[model samples]
Target: MLRATSLSIVLLALCACGSRAPAPQAAGVAAPDARGPTANAGNHAFQAAITADDFAAHVQALASDGFAGRGPGGIGEDRTIEYIKAQFARIGLQPGNGGDWFQTVPMVETTADESAVLGLKVGQTVQQLTFGDDMVVGTRTGQARVSLQDSPLVFVGYGVDAPERDWNDYAGIDVRGKTVVMLVNDPGFHSGDARLFDGERMTWYGRWAYKFEEAARKGAAAALIIHDTAGASYGWDVVRNSWSGPQYDLPAKDDPAPRLPVQGWISGEAADALFKAAGQDLAKLRAAAGRRGFRAVPLEASASLQLASRSVEKHSRNVLGLLPGSDAPDEAIVYMAHWDHLGTHEGGTGDAVYNGAVDNATGVAGILEIAEALRAAPKPPKRSVLFLAVTLEESGLLGSKYYVAHPVIPLAQTVAVINLDAMAPVGKAHDITVVGKGSSQLEDLLKVAADRQKRRLVEESHPAAGYYFRSDHFNFAKAGVPALYIGSGSDLVEGGIAAGEAASRDYNEHRYHKPGDQYDPTTWKLEGIVQDLEAVRSIGETLASSGQWPNWREGSPFRAARDAMRAASVGSR
Candidate 1:
């Protein structure tokens, strides 16, 4: 999860609509045991390997203020990597990247000047939108100075141009040298119509990254998404906090995607005001935009913005450790988590350290614990198990992207990827929420493991949030690897589903992507996390031992990529 400056209203609405918070815990009330169904499961050897104490210890050390939030390219990165490497060594795993524990990811860091402003003009009336409040803008063009003067503004609906779905928001419109404004998510989300863009479930087209790329390909001077708490899956505060910090991206020369001069997000209130100034109703436009054959509308106003930025080139490392397979060492299973977060942002109130306790400290720690468990197993996995703690994930999955480009093991031989990111602090539950649940056969293996724990598997509670595409695993998925992302369930045994849902809402509102994400052993229920880890370990072991090569589901977007890779492999053999 990306850092946010404000609490998300959409997050609140979704949580409330689906499940209300459970009753508050009385002072000094003990939390549930971290030992879930695994304690009595048939797989005694596997269950005995993961422990609550070990998991809690890892999170506490990684999330502690001593690491300075684990920001990539910052001093924190140095500490985080060394810590992960030392842990892997302690567990007796070999260095994964050809005798080296680290893989260098080249990046360019850009920090926009705080004084930048977005200027809007309609006739003689001029409104200047200040940075961090009315809007958040930046330049990914690798230019120190960027400007757009008197550029005409156009509303491009969701800014999606998917010919496969017969949807094109920019039809019959020339957006060259113009500023394109669009909604945050896809059509089906706003209209609640199943026929439009995966119904309520968000597709890749709805992501902010896709919006900017599509706008740039269409030759727009800038692309700005109108942020709504419900639509963006985050609050205006989140937009501000995330965009204002130092931004990292692959070196422009390395990145092939066309990028616009300016890309950012505008607060919902600001977008509505702009709509009114242009003689259109924001709500009405959204409704019409969700329908088929909607045309892009030109706003009667013009927008101008100048951004001044400072740039630096640096290299961050991806920490990798391997438990080489005793049998087929070339074939592998990968477990990954990002080891970076929003570094120290001086602008934050109270505490400036954006301690990402849950955002990713938990992920890094979880993988480390999993590594230890695998090392202690009675028999080594038949396929190599690579533990990857990547850097710059908060900076748009750059490290993972780089790894995929320069893989330690060929993508074709890799069996599957299991990613853990921003795990919740809630304790054991009756089920596990698998993000992007139906995409591949990996879930089938997960179901077998979950069944052993006497638990069930459920889809992500908030599919509309588009979390499946938000983490490091997406890079692997795009590379034809079947990736699995699961989280602690919201079906708490103590407070039941109500309690579980309440815990989740509380984290999204107060802790997610914020400095408030500090670890609290006094109240934390690691049993649930430990339970989840055991299941993940079980899945990896099963895949490693079996001859089955899990494939993507029939119509999954990544299916063709996997199929082509498999066919090519067979031809090569």
Candidate 2:
């Protein structure tokens, strides 16, 4: 899981959101037998192999304080990958990456000096904003000292430039060498207007990563997104915690995305004060920015920042294990989960290890259990199944991104991706929440599997948070592979939505990304997660056993890429 960077606190409001229509069932698809996969004795064997006890054991071992929170490039990472490799070997999976169990992902880890401050000069007065309080900034250039001098600031509405939507915030303004200030999310979010950019449901443009990328493309010297709880979907504390530590990025040769010299978030209070100091009303500008044809607003201020950072170049590993197919071994199905989390906080008071028990010790355990089940089955599928436990997800999905770039199997021949992240342990539920539902045929497969369990599939309660783009599957999705990410549904079979909501809220407020996220067997429940793993495993098994090439649905942003790749694959043959 990627922490609060994309997980919405709005998930806590699942109960209050009222009734959501059931996800559209895949047409003409017959549900599997509810008694389990009994047609083939092998299928039944695999199903029986996935048990609550085994899943719990994996979680316990991975989330144990001895793992040191599984931080990438640390001792925790060493133990974590070795543990995964050992498990894979025990389960009879072969090395997936060219006869090697590990794929080395080169990364540059940069930790910015937190004592640095952002200085805003409006007219003759200079207002200084403290780091971690008023603003959080970092440099991707891998520089020790990144300085900006008197860079003029321009308020770019949502920092979006979608020509298809007939909207451009930087239409007449050249932001080159200037600081581009923007609001969080996209134009449609705050306005409540479905006519604009997918309405409340966030598009790719709404993500902060997108905003920064667009700003970098425009030659901006610096980019600052004004943070609001509703817009970013998390609080300033999340931003502070996530950004305050060492940030990781792939080497330039590997990732080639436009790099920003400096970029970060500004608190709403700080943004308001800055806007007022520049003789602009933050509220009014926000409202105006939501409307179409909104132009950039140049603030009467210049910004200067001096950032000092400690940079370390290191290599992380993505642990891979393969169960080769009987027929089409080259064609593959991928089951992935991020294995890294916020590691032990140096010099912290108490309970420093961010165990990430739910954020994703659960997810890693999930794939392991699924792998065990498949490996124990009487027969292998026609297409290979790859169990991937990736690193640096907390840093930004870096491991998965690298894998997609340099894959063991070509992206064109890849069947589909099933991602498990932050699976809620809220016991058995009546339904499962599909993050970014209706985007692919994978959901249809999931729906059929859910039907077998007497459960329904439902859309994530808060789509505006863009949970789809948050996880590792997103890297595969962006590359045109059909990817599915599902979280445990809040509609618990015992307590319904209310209990689910309460649990979600408690996790978000108290434990999420904190030391409080330790594994507690006393309180932890595994039945629901077992069901989730089995359901997703069914989807993977179905894909592996057949020749189906699942794809992104029409109108999906990733559809074009998928169509192009498939076409090219056919033409190449």
**Could you say which candidate leads in TM-score?**
2
Q: How high is each candidate's TM-score?
A: 0.91, 0.92
| Candidate 2 TM-score, C-alpha based | 0.92
Q: Go through the candidates in order and give each one's C-alpha lDDT.
A: 0.79, 0.81
Local accuracy of candidate 2 as per-residue lDDT tens digits, 38-114: 22111222233889877777777777766677778876777778888877887889999979999999998888898
| Per-residue lDDT of candidate 1, residues 1-573 (tens digit) | 222111111222121111000111222222222343122112222223678776766777677666667777655677678878878887889999998999999988888887988998877777789998998888887799999999999999999999999999999999999999999888999999999989878898988888899999999999989999888776777677667757878887777888989998888888888899888999999999999989999999899988899878888999999999988999999999888876565532476565677767788878988888888889888899999999877778788999998999989988999998777666778888788889999999899889988888887766778877778888999989999988777677777777765665677778766678888988887887788888998888887887779999999999999989988987999
Q: What CA RMSD would you report for each candidate?
A: 7.5, 9.2
- Show pairs that collide, candidate 1: 4-238, 5-237, 5-238, 6-237, 6-238, 34-527, 428-528
Q: Give the clashing residue pairs of candidate 2, or none.
A: none
